[model samples]
Target chain A: MKNASSFCLLLVSLITPSLWPIIGHADGVFAFSPEQAIHVRTLAASCAACHGTQGNAMVKEGGNTSEENNPVLAGRTREDLLSKLLGFRDGTRKATIMHQHSRGLSLEEIDLLATHFSMQIRVIRPPLSPQKLEAEHG
Target chain B: MAEPFNRRAFIKAIGATGLVLASRPSLAMASKPPMGRVVIVGGGYAGATAAKYLRLWSLGAIEVVLVEANRQFVSCPMSNLVLGGSKSINDLTFGYEALQANHGVIFRHDTVTAIDAAAKHITMLGGTLSYDRLIVAPGVDFNYQEWPMLASLDAQKQVPHAWKAGWQTVNLRQQLETMADGGVFVMNVPKAPYRCPPGPYERACQVASYFKQHKAKSKVIVLDANAEIISKKGLFAKVFNETYAGIIDYRPDNAISHINLATKTVSTEFDSVKADVLNFIPPQRAGKIAQEAGLTEKDYPWCDVNFLTYESKLVPDVYVLGDSVAAGLPKSAHMATNQAKVCASAIVQLMSGSLPDVAPVFANTCYSFINDHAAMHVANVYRYDAGKKMMVSAEGGGVSISPNEKEAGYAHAWANNIWADTLS
Candidate 1:
C-alpha cells in the first residue's frame, strides 16, 4: 500500500478552508430545528442518484428531448415542487416511478423536501458529452 | 492530559514540516470545531456516497478518510451493457479524483489488513488510522468453498466469474467475441440472497442480444439454481420466450454440481452442459473485510445492522452498508446509495449528540435492459418498520408494463447521474 500519512494531514488542514463556502450559506427559512434539517437534507440527497447533486439534473449536450430526461429540481418554486410531489402521492398525476417514492413519505416530510430542494442553488452543468469507451481502460 | 489537535496547531505543524498544502479558495470560517473522524473502507457506491454526504451534512465538522484498494471505480450496474456490445469497460470505469478534489475527502489508496474495533483503530498495509466511527461498505465476496479448485486467481482467468466488474468483465467479453458461430455460451446463477438479484437474468439478455444481432446461430443457455427466475420473472420470461425465442435457453432449478474446466463443461443433477464459453457466478457473502472484522453473524453470510443507522448489530460503532448488509431487498446500486445516505445522516447526528431519524424512508429503482435498445424497471419505496426493525417495501411499488426504447434512454441517464452522484 502507498503511504500517504503526510498527504492525508495536508488534505485535512485544507478541508475547512475549501469546503465552508459551499456549505456555509445558511437556509434560515426552515421551520424545523437544525436536527430536522439534517434528516431532510439526507432525504433530499437520496434523490441525487437520479437527479444531479443539489437537484440540478444533468442534460445531454444540445438538450435531450427524450422521455428519459430527469427533471431538474433545484431552485424550482416551493409551490410547484410541493404540488407536483403531492400530485404524485395522491395519484392526481401519472409518473413512471415518482408515485412509489412520494407515497412512502408523509405530507409534512414531502413539504420539507420540496422546501429543501427549492432552496438549493441550482448549477446547471455544462452540457455533458457521453463517455467514450476503449478496449483497455487501464 | 494531551492537547487536542486543533486546526491552528495542525496547520502550524504542517507549516513547520515544510509540507506544501493545496487549497482552492478560503471561505467563511467554520463556527464549530472538528467533532470527529470517520474512516470508510471501500470506495464503491455506498462508501463514496457516505463520505460525500457526511461531509456535506456535517458542514466540514466531521473529517472523512476514504480508504479504497482500487484507485478507480468500475460500476457493475452498466457492466451488462459491455456484454451486449453497446458499451465498454472504459465507459464504466472512473477515477476517485473528483470525489477527493471536490469533497475535500482524504483519499487513501490502501488495503485494510486488520481491524481493532475495541481500540477504534484500523491496521492497513501502509499505516494505522484511528476513527471515532468506521463504515465498512465492502461489497460481496465470492464464496468458492463448494469448488475450491476454481477459487485461485489463475483458474478465474480461464472460466471468468465477471461478477465484480473488473478485468474479468473484459475477459468474459473477449471470450464471447472470439467464440465461433453456433457456439454455446453457458452461465450459472448462484443461489438467491446474492448480490443484485436480477443481474444474472440481465446478463443472459445482454448475451442473447449480442447473439441476435451478430452471431445468429449462437446459443445462450442460462442455468439457474433457483426454481424459477428470481427477479422481474414475468418480464424476463417474456423477453426470453418471445423476444429471443430460439437463441436463449433458460433452465431453472439446475444448479452446478461439478465443472470440468479442461473441457469447459458443467454438470448438474439432471443434465450435462458443454459450452464454448463459461461464466460461473459463484455463491457470495459479506465481503472478506466484513467477515474479518466480525461484522457478519456466525451462521449467516450477511451482516445484521440497526436499520436506522446501519451500525452493525455485531460490532459497536462500526456500520455496514451495501450488499453486505442482510436485507430482504435487492442489493442494487440505487439501494446501496440510499442506505449510505441514511447511514451518513445517522452518523452525523450521532456525532453531534442528536438523535438519528427513526422512520427512514428511501426508494430503489433498478432497470433491466431486454436488449441494447429496450429496458424495463422495478421500482419500490422502502420505509423502516419499527416492529420488524427492518426496511419493508411500501405500496405503489411495481415493475414496468413492458420494455421500451424510451426506458433505455432513462437507464443510461440513470447511470450517468448515479456515476456523477457517487463520484463527483
Candidate 2:
C-alpha cells in the first residue's frame, strides 16, 4: 500500500507540473521561449481580422484610405503603443473597450505586443506565377 | 527543443526562419522531419489551423493527419449574413483542398467515435489509428433537455438554432422566407458563454435587416435570457435603436423555462410568447467525443486545459482547443484559431523535448456586422497568468466605438483573411 501511494504521487506530479506556481525559472518546466515569440506573432495576426495586417484599418488597397473612426496602429513606435495602453489601463486616456482589455496586462507584455506590431510592414502581395495561372485556366 | 534557450535567444534565433517562412511557406514542408505522427479530430477553425501550423512549424518533419466528419467547413462568422441575404452559404463554406495540397496536411473524412488516451489511439468508423499526440477541437454540443420542443427532428426543423451554419442556417432562412407578412419571428438567446455571445444579437440584426428589405411589415422579436446584451453591448444597442428599432423587438432576462412546439408557444417564469417562427439556441457544452473520453470532469461543460499548451489537464498528451476549452475567454472562432497556433507550437517544441512558453501572448477579435453596410468589432491581446493558469487579457486591445460603412469593408476582408489563414 505504501509503494502504491508513492507511485500515485509520482503519477500526479508527472501529469501536472503546471499546477505549481513558479511557472518560469525552472528546467523541464513551462516558461517563455523564442518559439513563444513566434507563436505570439501568429496571435497578433488575429489583429488583422479588424486592424488590417498593417494595423491601419482605414487604409485600403492601392493607397486608398477610408474616412474611418478608429486610429491606425501601423508605423507607430513601440513606445507609442505602450504609452497609449498604459493610459487606457490607468484611466488617463479615455476609451471604451481599450480600458477593459488593457486592465490586466503587465508592462512587459504590453511592450512585447506593441514592439512586434510596430515592426510590421504594410501589405504586399506577390504576383501570381504565369505557369500556375496557365495550369488553373487550362 | 535542444538546450534550455530562454525567451530572448529563442526570439532572435527564429527571425531568420521567419524570412524563410515568408519567402516560401511550403519549402520547408518539402522534406519530412524527425517529429512523428499527430492526429487531430474535427476540422473546424481550431483543428484545421492546428494541422496546417503543425506541419509548417515542424517544417514537414512530422506527419499530421486531420480527421473531420464533414468534408466542407461552414463558418459561423458571416453565416448570419445568409439570413440577411447579403451572403450565401457557399460564401462561408471551405474545403480542405488547400490545406492538403499547400500545407501537406493529410485529411481524413471520418467521424471519431472514442479516444483511448492511455493507449494513445482513437477509434472511428474506418479503424483505430495511433498517434504521438491527439488534438480534439470538436467545438460545442447543444443540451436539449430543458426544451422538449427540440427533442424531435420535426420540432428541431421548425425551431432551428441556425448556430452551426449549415442546414440549420438554411432552415432559419427558409422559415423567414415563408413566414406571413406582419407575422411574428421570435428568436431566444441562450444565457452567456454560449458559442459566440454576440451571435444571437447578430442573428436578430440579420433577420431585422431582411425584414426591412423583404418583409417590412413583419415583427422580429429577440428574447434574451441574459440580463443584457452579452457582447459589444453599446454597439448592438445603438444599431437596434437606430437601424432596427421598429423591426426588432428585444426583451432581456426572459429565460425560456418551457418551449411548446405543439402550440408554437415559448414561456418563461410567468410570461409566454406565441410566434409564427421560433428560433431556439439552447445551452451548450463541449462536444461528446471529449465527454466519451471522460475528459469533461467536475460537471464542467468544456474540458479543462493548461491554456499555455491547451493540453487537457485530465488527459495527458491529449489537447483540446476551440469551444471545447473551458477558458474564460469568449467561445469564438477567433479564439479557436489563436489557441490552435499556441497548441501547435507547444506540440512541436515538446516533441523536440522542449517545454512550452509559459508567458505566451495571444489575441482575439469579436466582429459584428450590424447590417450589410455597417460593422463593428472588439479586439484584445492576452498573456498567460501563472496565478490563475489562464490566458488573461493584455494590452493593444480596443473596439470600434464609432463604426461605419468603411469599417464594413474591413469586416468582409477580415472574413476572407481568417478563412484563408485557417484553410489555406
Candidate 3:
C-alpha cells in the first residue's frame, strides 16, 4: 500500500506542475464571480430578443429602427458595452429609444447584460454591394 | 522500516494540506488591513481614471476616495459638435457608477476648499479628510483678468468661455442659435500652453461649417494669439478653404488686448472687430487647490512631478496628475487617463516596498472633428528621461494626416473610441 501511494503522489505532482499554472493564471483574470455570471445571464434576455441567440444576429424583419442609426452589439468588449449601457441608463448617452430601454434595467442587470453580450461572437454582415442593389431594383 | 501512519492516510493528509496551503495565499491576501487612504480631487477624465486604476492595481489593499465638485462629468472631448448643432449635451455626459461599483472607490460630491498639505489633509465643504496620498487633477481655471473688460463675474454674463462642460456649452450654443444670418461670430484663441490646444480651432471649424450650411451669409472670424495654430493645421485650413471658403476669416498672430462689452467689440493687436457673438477662451492655470498646496509655481496652477511616477517634487506621498501637473504632455482626456494608469501602478509598487522600473510608456491621441463627416487625429508615445527629469515624445510620434474626406470621417468614429477608452 505504501509503495502504491508513493507512486500515485509522484504521478499527481508531475501532472499538477504543468496544469496548475494555466488554471491559476486564468482564475486571476476574472473580475467577476460565479454569482455575477448568473446575474448577467438573466439580464441578457431582453437583448437576446432583438440581437438573436447570444447576441449573434440582428432581427431582420422586426428591427424597425434604421440600420444607419442602430449599432449592433455582438462581440463588443464588456467594458465598452457597460459604459454605453450605463450612459444610456443614466440618461447621459441620450438616445430617444435606447434611453428608455436602458433606464428600465437595474445597475446589476446592466452589468450582467454587458457581460453576457460581451461573451458572444460578433457577426457583421458585409455592406450591401451595388450589384446586389441593382439586381433587387430590377 | 516503520511508518507513522498507513500510506493511504499519509498521502491523503499531504494532499489536503497542499490544497489548504494553496488556498492560504488568497486568504492571506484578503486578510491584509487596508492601507493608507488616497483622496483624488476632480471627477474628469484625469481624477476618475486615477481613482479607478489606483483601486485596480492595489488589489483591494488601498482605500480610495474621489472628491468631485459636480454630481456628473460632461466631457469636453467633443463638445464642439454641440456648438455645430450636430450633437447634444446629453451625448457627452457620463456618470460615476462604473468607478464606484467595479473599482470600490468612494465618491464625494463636494467642492474641495483647501489642501492642508503639511497635515496631508484636504478640506471640503462637508468636512476635512486625511490621505496617505492625494492626487490633484482639478483641471484648468480660466484667467478672466486677461480680458479686462470681461474680467469680472458680471462681464462673463456677456462673453462666454464655455470651457468647462455643461451649462457653459449650452449657453454658447444658444447664443449661436439666436444670431442673425450674415451676422459675424468672433472666436479668440489664447496663447500656447492652454488646455486642449486644438479645441478652439475645432470649435471654430464646427461653428463655421454650421454657418456655411444653414446661414451661408454669416461669417466666422477666428483671431489667433500665436504665430501658428498648433494641431491639424494643414488639414483644417484646407477644409476651411475648400468647404467654407468665404465663411471663415482666419487671422494668425492677432492677440486680443481688450474687449468692450458695452460696445460689443474686441480690440486685438491687429485691429478692433465688432460682432454679434463673442467667444473668448482665455489663458488658464491649474485650479486654485493646486496653487494652495504649493504644487504650483507663480502664475502656474500645477505641481512639478516625476512624469513617470507622478509623485510631487515638493511634497512626499502626494501625486499630481492630469491638467493640474506641469507634465510636458498635451492636456487631452486621453493623456490624462494614460498618466493616471502609470501613476496608479507606481503608487502600488511604492506601497509594496517594490522599486518600479523606469521609463513607462505614456500615450495620447487627440481627435478633432472638422465637420460631421471629417476629422483628424494626433497621437504620440512619450517616455520620461531620468537625466532631464522630463517627459519627452519619442521620435516619429505625431499626428496622422487623414487621407481624404472619407477617411476624415473616421475622426468622428475615433471620438467614440476615445470616449469609451477614457470614461467607460
Measured over the true interface residues after superposition, the C-alpha RMSD of each candidate is 3.0, 7.9, 19.4
Point out the higher-scoring one by TM-score: 1 or 2.
Answer: 1
TM-score of chain B only, all predictions?
0.94, 0.92, 0.89
True contacts recovered per prediction: 0.45, 0.20, 0.00
Q: Indicate whether candidate 2 or candidate 3 has the larger TM-score.
A: 2
Which candidate number maximizes TM-score? 1
lDDT of 2 at B61: 66
Cα lDDT for residue B341, candidate 2? 85
Task: Write candidate 1's Cα lDDT for B1-424 as tens digits.
Answer: 2213345533332232222112312222332456889999999999999988887666666788899988778899989989999988878888777666656677788899888899898988888888899999999999999988799888988899999887889899999999999999999999998989999999999999999999999999999999999999999999999999999999999999999988999999999989999999999999999999999878789999999999999899999999999988899899999999999999988998889997888778899998888999988878889999999998778888899987788887788788888887
* Candidate 3 error regions (>4 Å): A1-138, B1-31, B152-154, B299-301, B403-424
Error of 1 at B412 (Å): 1.1
Please give, for residues B168-267, the per-residue lDDT of candidate 3 as tens digits.
7877889889999989999988887888988988898899978977888999989999888777788777766777789888889999887888877988
Model 1 share of native interface contacts? 0.45
Clashing pairs in 1: none
Q: Which ten residues in a row have the lowest lDDT in candidate 1 chain B?
A: B16-25
